[model samples]
Target: MAARTITNRKARHEYHVDETYEAGIALTGTEIKSIRAGKANLQDSYARVENGELILYNMHISPYEQGNRFNHEPKRPRKLLMHKREIMRLLGQTREKGFSLIPLKLYFKNSWVKVELALARGKKKYDKREDIAARDAKREMDRAMKNRHRE
Candidate 1:
């Protein structure tokens, strides 16, 4: 099966990602069907270490239309599978200095569902403006260079 990736672009703009980790997600049967149909949303989704286990919250997977009473909850907390040591390390970082664990994306790896998690810090308003300015400057320079080469 082809690998499918669903990404949260807003997370990149709103947070400074310092590190990334891949983790397996515990999904229900109907939820998996919904995800395979590209009906999952990572926006506003985040992970936290709870009781020594990582739990994902606010992640929405639309209920399968074909599913009747067996449909899964759209916004249920899901467990993430990771090593004990990794979870412990992330717990420390997330507790300090306005750090958080955000889910960057979800994808299928050889039929198993995986999430791309990040250790991130929230971006300030000025930092966001600076990044926009830099991006605009780079675009303008590239346009200038292209026109110059054409002349």
Candidate 2:
């Protein structure tokens, strides 16, 4: 199967992910086919605990072209299938401190759709800048090492 990525670009820029979980998504046949065709988007997607269950919101799965009126909504709030204990833990973490449920990536795993959810904290302006600087320094160091090896 061809590997595809549906990534939440803003999540990386906004939050520092502390942990990640892979959860199954409740998807219909048409939605699954559409995702297989690489027509899914996770740009603004997020997850929340509601009624003791995890629900995904703002995720856009494009409608299957061959589907008729039975096609699923592109932006529906889909349920995420996670264990009860995991859900409770996520709820506690999110409710307590700077943690939030953010969708990091969406992809097919063993022919099944899976969402990679991150427990993250929002980064401040200074933190973001520091991260950028650190990344730049790491890149420069890597380049220097490569040049030293070449010489």
Candidate 3:
């Protein structure tokens, strides 16, 4: 089967990502099935280092259709597996003002489920405007280049 990836599209537009790390996610059997079916969401989700462990919060993995009473909670807090040292580093980095941990993508790595976690800072309104302007300018430049090539 083709590997599936679920991405947080708004994360980049809302935050300035500094670093990313691939980490394994701890999921229940039903949750795994749900994710395999591409029934997960990363919107309004974030991660935190609590008691030396990386825990992802607010990520919504819909319940498995056939799970019955065995279905996992759709918005349960999922623990992320990483080396202790890496978790420590992330903890320290997130301690800085305005810095936070956000999940950028969720996908299958081989047969295992993995999350692409990012260390990011929230962007101000002016910063967002500047980004939009820059993107627009780049798009126009690309269009102009394409027209020139055609001519």
How well does each candidate superpose onto the true structure, as a TM-score?
0.94, 0.91, 0.95
What TM-score should be assigned to candidate 1?
0.94
lDDT of each: 0.95, 0.92, 0.95
Off by over 4 Å in 3: none
Q: What is the lDDT of residue 25 in candidate 2?
A: 95
Tens digits of per-residue lDDT, candidate 3, 15-40, equal 99999999999999998888888999
Point out the worst 10-residue segment of candidate 2 by lDDT.
1-10
lDDT of 1 by residue, 1-151 (tens): 4446889999999999999999999998999888888899999999999999999999999999999998999999999999999999999999999899999999998889999999999999999999999999999999999999999
Rank by TM-score, descending?
Answer: 3, 1, 2
Higher-ranked by TM-score: 1 or 3: 3
Report the CA-based lDDT of candidate 1 relative to the real structure: 0.95
Candidate 3 worst ten-residue window by lDDT: 1-10
Report the Cα lDDT for residue 16, model 2: 94
lDDT of 2 by residue, 1-151 (tens): 5667778888988999999999999999999988888899888778999999999999998999999999999999999999999999999999977888999989888878899999999999999999899999999999999999999
Residue 46 error, candidate 3, Å: 0.6
Q: Candidate 1, residue 41: CA error in Å?
A: 0.7
